[model samples]
Target chain A: MRKWILLLAVFLAACTTKPSFTSENVYVGTDGVSLAFTKNSPPAEVFENSIFPVGIEIWNKGAYNVEEGYALVNLDQDYMEPGEFTGSTSIFPSDASKLDFQLMGKSEISQQGDRDTIGLTVLTKPIDILSEKHTSTVSVMACYRYQTFASPNVCIDTDPFGIRENKKSCTVSDIPLTGGQGAPVAVTKVEVKMLPSKSQDKVVSQFRIYVKNMGNGQVVDASKVADACSSEGLTKSDINSVSVSAQLSNGIVLDCIPKREGNGGLEGYLRLKGEDYVLCNYEEGVPMELGTFKTTLNIALDYGYMHSISKDVTIRKSAVI
Target chain B: MEQKRVFLGVLVIVSLLIIGCSGSKGNQPTAVEFRTGSSGLDVTFPSGTPQQIFENDIDVRIPIQVENKGAFPQFDELSEFTGFLWVGGYDPNILQASFEQGDIRKQLDPEELEGRSSFNQQGGVVLESLILSVGDLPLGTAVYEPTLIFYLTYLYKSIASVPVCIDPEPRSINVKDKVCSLTDFRKIYSVAPQGGPVGITNVEEIITSNQIIFKFDLQNFGTGQVIARDLVSSNPNEGFDWRDLNRVQIEDVRLGDRSVDKCKPDLGEEVELFQGIGHFQCTLSVASIASAQAYTTPLTVTLTYGYAQSQFRNIKILEAIEI
Candidate 1:
């Protein structure tokens, strides 16, 4: 009887704990969806004018379920033609419009994420065999929508000058980060500063958040996820584009300013190319009376990521005349 | 193999340390740090200057103290052109300097006035004395007060040496592992700003394929007004205008011998500072660098601008009772 009572009490305590993505260790890792060429699927060598199949296995290592039409697989058309496969498709489509629909993500109950496969069976076009053979690289690209969320306890010192005699909870200093927040685009650091405002009496809380692309794929604009793998609508500007938003646990929304965007409050392109910083400030200046305290900073980065792996195959002329 | 990698890592780190230690090349630092203090000359009245004096007493003297609080006047660079100290904004006949010179128009030290540094925080100070005879209270029976302005003008230079990452091919076709490519290695190193009224506040380095651009934030980090090197004179009271307040000139911008060109606001134009804050952009050709990895190098920017400082003192003269 006593054992049962103790177990119920322990479970109740856990139920009351706050739901924090980082503290609770939910969907936490530096990696998102990863794709690789299945072993021996795309044979090492093939005969000219013959058909071959390219198989890729994608694993969703993150916690967000990828909806149908959200994950697109593309085939490199320069080397081979989808002769017998799904012919004449979207910008650069696979045998199917999208990968496996309703691909579930990692959950507490199911520790390991879902897995799916894509097959691009194509007919090799005749090529001029120089000497022994002509080798070609068959590349498969997987572009999918992903998000990176990081929640770290940050110091918000309203009384940075120590005007009051009361003891403070936290002090303001730069928060440096290592590893990553389980996304291709990761927040590297956050610089905390208490600046004097125009009024002189109030202190403005400003944070410089640094971000970088930490994946084996290319970053595409979140709005153009479908066309990322094909390079149809993707331009130089569209590449390396990421949307960013941040807020405090206390419901105080921050005004985020990217280097490219002069105005604050808007997102996207928060960083330039691979690395940059975004300047955000508490829209409402922290009053001096509140003293110092600690709060969780929730930073969200959204973007379309595409990873490609190619297998080289040597095609020998069937009948060398 | 592990030992080989460790040896290579140590070699790279040692090489970077050597590069960081190599400042401008020809010039070796005399002090621990150069950037310190805001005022070119910290002027104050130590002892000789008194607040009140009896009419016809004739024993009024003020020793004006001037300290080279900033790294300028460079005594050696200025030669004899350091500038002059003038006493204006008061009646000349009522109060004279030293009772012999008739007016206070004196040349500076004729010797070296060293600026402030980490080793010598107080810097070099020079004292100029003024012997005055308080005249008979304007012949009127009461107390008279006059606000005296001690004007100081000198040519000063503010130089900022910043460490920047130079990628040979900023926009290379294929990206690989480089020293400064990682965010952990790329951090803002806040060395002291070269000391003066006008200072380079922050530097933003942007790396693109063909070009390496830098945006430098300019600020008047001092309490005095910055005068254009050409416009700074002994007495700007009679000939000064609004145009002289925020004017500065870029003397030299270089990375060792290679000149950083394609600068915004041009090179020779009088760079006007808006408010206390202003900025300029300059680009370095990455084509010159043929290395695969990014290396750290020093970017030295020299700016020549004149600074004007004034300290005011109010004095009262009371009529002596006729015995």
Candidate 2:
């Protein structure tokens, strides 16, 4: 019974013990195993806010009989956490998806003696975090053909890589206030031409009126009556009582005739007494010319008391000149 | 008997070994667990007539009551707690005290609370002073509806922690009976330039020089009265310069009732001009000859006054224009 027990213990110990597999006196053929990251399959660049997917493939070259061993890849310690392989599957799984990887294809390679070159491809689905920076590593492992030996874990020393960048939106603040309606006013164009009346020694000029809506709204029942006038060239004492007729270019007769005044200047008020008289000043008048007696008409609107409109007009000399 | 003794000895040794090994692996306090309790406290300000407080009146008595519904015991000594009072996001530059132990309780010295004001004469009332204390508190004692925060120094084993905090709940306070007086007379407030020429010709530079001046229509607005004096001017990139410009007495210059002697009167009653209109004319100097870039300067005018010398107070108004 004692002998049987000792034998059982010896068997258990032998089963647990692993044979020594050292790299000594082992002749390596010219076809040495070489590992590389696959082409057209580089790791993805991750933005600060988004995620990236990566895959990696490895190539092994060895002439002599080699064991079917697995590869272990180690990401740079500073940038990424250590990554491990999934069970028998070729893909690698990462605990943190928010990481940037350097290489995409197979991060690990297995040693199969039947083929001159062995390859592996690993896919790492990682998310790129905008809040922080990250990096990853790649490595390979091979197993010997004999059960008694295995190859050392091989890893390529490469710089860590980051995911693609995500752009930040530009923003601004504190915009100023603007936009409001200004004052209300109006403008009128007057043309004066000196004509030889039937009984006058000097030529008398007839004043033609052209009223334009220059305020913010339309004008209705506008009465263009002269309040005062200059006696510099006229001979009438009731110049203040002198009434003259006027009309708009739209063929509408003005409500009241132009009244004369003794102020030696043509002074009048156009009573634009209506609510819908909405019209902008700049679009109200057409450019006209009368031969050389330059003058401007100033019209005041009731709404904006301080604002007024002015238009340039010309008077022609009689044929006597 | 010898064989029995040997067997007993072996058994004893085996039992001792097993006991020693198990003892080595006994329960240990390896990982520490930290527990925290959260609570809040509400503070109130007494309502009454507006108090008139001057710079000379430094120490002001503010009544504050602290109620704790948390599991922690109320601090026996008020000295263990720290408090702060904020008015309109500013320190009112006055010391706060309460009645405690048959004496006026002052947490901070008067020097620490001096020389702090809202700068802008905009008034603010003190809602409450947040008080915080750290000590062994019961589980629910420190946790209340309104959290109470104060400066506290506590020790857990060899580690000591001090936390400063404020109550996050919203509160309101009455305007205390106090008045602030100004020693210097500063800028007079007025509206910005308006009704000026729309189109300026011969544009050597877009001169804001041709300005249309209008008096502060006393009849329409009011008798422009001033109390405190604070003249503030700001540039584009630079900040505002708040300084005491000059001191002048208030002379009533209204057209109808109060007009200065030798001043002309027009339109019904005599219009009074408060101060020099020329003084308020801000010139917009052209900085660049080619670029149309212009800078806007804003002037903030603050007045300090009262019904009498004994009841002085201050107020502020702002005016800005593109220069």
Candidate 3:
């Protein structure tokens, strides 16, 4: 009896699938490159006329490598100065307090993301004669270009008049998705509809893809990311825009309409203000005899994300002064 | 020993008495199984609505209590909602309602609000605040009394499943022990009304050589009036008018899977209920190729109509400080 029990256990174990991490699974997470102030980077209190260090850590928690990224620190210039970290001799983020590049995202070999740090020594300028203490908010910005890859199963029904319901593998319905799909932006839902063709040939598939910025960052237009960090200042339109394009598994790209031109043909990308969706139609109506089938809808969202974190530092007057 | 035996006999008698008493009166008081009722919804304006309000009183609230008092319940999956309610009959400028023109058309219950039954005797009561502070009442020279009419409109369905005998040849005298006689079909079959305010009360059958004719009598068991589908205004701006009452739409009359297409209402498809009853007749064509064997099919009569009930209130807006 004991031997039979052992054999039964072995058979059950063999039937169960051993869980393993695939290359696709490594890229799935809700995190993106984030900026954090190290513990006491700007000490709780700093004496007047004394020099202190402000530090920021840039962590790439996403799967995609950031080709062009930068971290800019903002401070009240009246009460502080870069001191020796400025002028022609300055090496800190090229004297402008902007740290660029040198960060790699998550990979198959290293499941965890790579991280880098930046520290800058600065002087606290003298305060007014009467004020005993002064406090200022120190903020840092991390901006990077990222991409989201989503492959959700889609239903395609070619036959119109034929009753293919009982035998069909897939039904046309909205597919709701949760959790992030390998990037800062996530495809939340895909509404599937098999509409009758206008030419009276057969039924065509139309999908509405809804995307949201899951990461705590303001989305930017992919084409304008380089310009945003460059000499040209970032405009209002440059923010809250995501470039989106989608295709089917059969290599037939979907034609998404209601496009707003300009921005590297991200296929008339949607302007993201919290959440948005795009409508794509399979224009070449499938031949009537194909019946009902299931295929994957591959969607790619290419955009720039910018996140910010702020800290407080109290400036106390020196005893002798 | 004799006294102990007497005591045992008394105990047995007492046990028998208790069992007999409980068994005889156990089912006397139970929740009433309400199959027939006169009203689907018992609507009444509760207290707090002022019959007279001064011009200074900016807020005048009127509350209307809507109770599902019939056997047909309002379910989310079966029907979108019980019906819509609107209050009109007063000048919009003088007495302005807090609700918008679109907001006036309100659904009775979005979720499941069951009607009268043995399980839920009182049914579901939805308190709808009708006039939430009728404001901007002009200070007239004399006492101004405006009659405000509050109308409730909702689509309701009434179904009747009647067991009917299909006779291939009713004139065949040689047939012995026939399944059901054409003259005695009324006594053989019964009409079961499937719980709606409007129901089929009686049915009379007529047999011909090639057709079976059925005459049905439909009545409004509800206290409220039935309205024509076309007469009710769907436009939010138009609201409810007085001309939209007393007509019921004959949706379908079917026997098993096949629809009896020859069914016709006495007046028309949308016929007005005289007093509270209406008549509908349909001719079911019997195929000449049917077998001599007699079979029975449940003839179903479905009616879709808008039920409406109204309550009017006369209010006088007096001057803030009497002259």
Candidate 4:
């Protein structure tokens, strides 16, 4: 009896022990839709005949079912539709067309499994897209129903697209279209005149330089010019002593008054007595290019001032009348 | 009367038997036999015997292994044992020499010796002798192995004659004086900023106000103690100033800053300064001073320090600052 009781107790203890069960489930689904484009031909040179043949593939990586979908290859607009399409075509628009683009066909990729892949090809003739060089996007969109056991089916839509481009228009051109000439300067004209002053034995010849629109661009203030005689070099005192005179080309001797009532170059008048003006003597002898007697007439203009044209005139002793 | 005589005779016989048994007990071998050599407990020297000098101690390892060869299980609980080293035939006079005179003659007293140095019982019995002074032993003298005897107690009975060999022979050393003297001054001139001008002075002040430091390297040139008094500077006029004649000094100086007095050299224990090279700096403070008067005198510093009864000199002169 005791043997039987022991066996029973052992059996009871074994039966009272609880058993545990464990299980694991793996699930994989698509997250969203994606679109990619492959070029069929090499890019065209800047001013050449080139056609861009592109193929686009849209992938839907989700556990949902897509009901209706469309892909539009429109310029400056969105492409969304549902159907089957083999390919599409577009002509690169001109300026008269105002940078417009068109879509031809549509294709549909039925949601068969958790992931569905759709492919579309776009063969576009070489268009002069460089006329309005800017960015354009080709988009693909689809609407699908998302279903799960824990929740009712939910409908979601998405549009994914890739860009087709003209390589020449996409990159900055190295050749500058304008303004390659050196720094521009503004000036109406420059005229030099010699007028006689008082004395006869020593003709007081006055050299005048007419500066028009003096303080215009780039060529502004004048640098100091050295005289043939002065050994110490030109000082501020020498620069200040020189006088500038302004006159009209029509011989209307206007008042030699400064425009701003200052000693500036803008419509300024300056005078030098014949004795005060020393003619420079060249030891190597003056070249024919330089007149026999040379005197520097320095006029200070505002910063960045330039003269488009300049002329020089000289007056000397007359043989006889 | 005859019966009484027979009884007495029997008693005499019993008494003789008892006496005989007591006599046999005395004759039984009191000497206990223990396994020796590698077969039993063994002593291993990590450094394979050491040749040490006077007052030098080395670690001696004695590995003990106990075997119960008896039929009945025997629990030998050796709580404590007495081990003794018998260094026989050593000249007592040599063991009595003074250490100061370079004599190895000195007796290492048991009371003054550390117990651990000579006795170990917890894990395999091992004992190392304390620092011994083998007084004035001739060179190439052989130090014999001392016999080690361990008194073991088992089952409350004391047993002697557990013999152990001193695996390797003890160290024998000849005493001699160690003399050290400064041989050369390796002047690792501080880089441009730190190095002083070798010939020219005054053109430009060294950016860093580092002194001309001289590394006085002393070599054990002679046989002596290299006594503290031996370190004497030969150039007394030079700035070879040492705070303590016994210890070397490191001098550090910065431009415009006062020279820091003798910096102590870091010497670790067990590392005897047999060849000591001290760095002494001679600062060019005069050149660093802004005023012309400061450099007018032109400072020339020479250092002299005593080293092994000889004088070492390090001379440095500060020239004028050019600008």
- The candidate that wins on TM-score is 3
Quote each prediction's TM-score: 0.43, 0.13, 0.45, 0.14
Candidate 4 C-alpha error for residue A220, in Å = 67
Write candidate 1's Cα lDDT for B30-108 as tens digits: 6466575555766788864578776676756678887787776454555634655656434333444442265556667
Which ten contiguous residues of candidate 2 chain B have the minimum total lDDT?
Answer: B151-160
Q: Model 2, B230-312: lDDT tens per residue?
A: 21111101111212111222222221122222212322222222341212111222222222322222211111111000011
| lDDT at position A299, candidate 2 | 21
Regarding lDDT, does 2 or 4 come out ahead? 4
TM-score for chain B of all predictions:
0.80, 0.17, 0.71, 0.18
Model 3 interface RMSD, one decimal = 30.5
DockQ for every prediction shown: 0.00, 0.00, 0.00, 0.00
lDDT (10s digit) by residue, model 2, range A216-304: 32222112111111112222331111122332221223333332334332233333433112111211222111111111111222211
| Alpha carbon lDDT at B148, candidate 4 | 18
Residue A202 of model 4, lDDT score: 22
> For model 2, how many clashes?
70
Candidate fnat values, all: 0.00, 0.00, 0.00, 0.00
lDDT of 1 by residue, A1-321 (tens): 999999999999999996874212333566778777777768998877888877767787775566632444343454466543232234324444344334566654554778876665767767664645677777666677777776555666655665432233346788877777656678889888888777654678888888888777788877777777443668777788877777754346678775345534445355356678888887568655434445556677777777776778887778858
Alpha-carbon shift of residue B142 in model 3 (angstroms): 80
Candidate 2 stretches with Cα past 4 Å from truth are A1-307, A310-321, B1-37, B44-79, B88-323
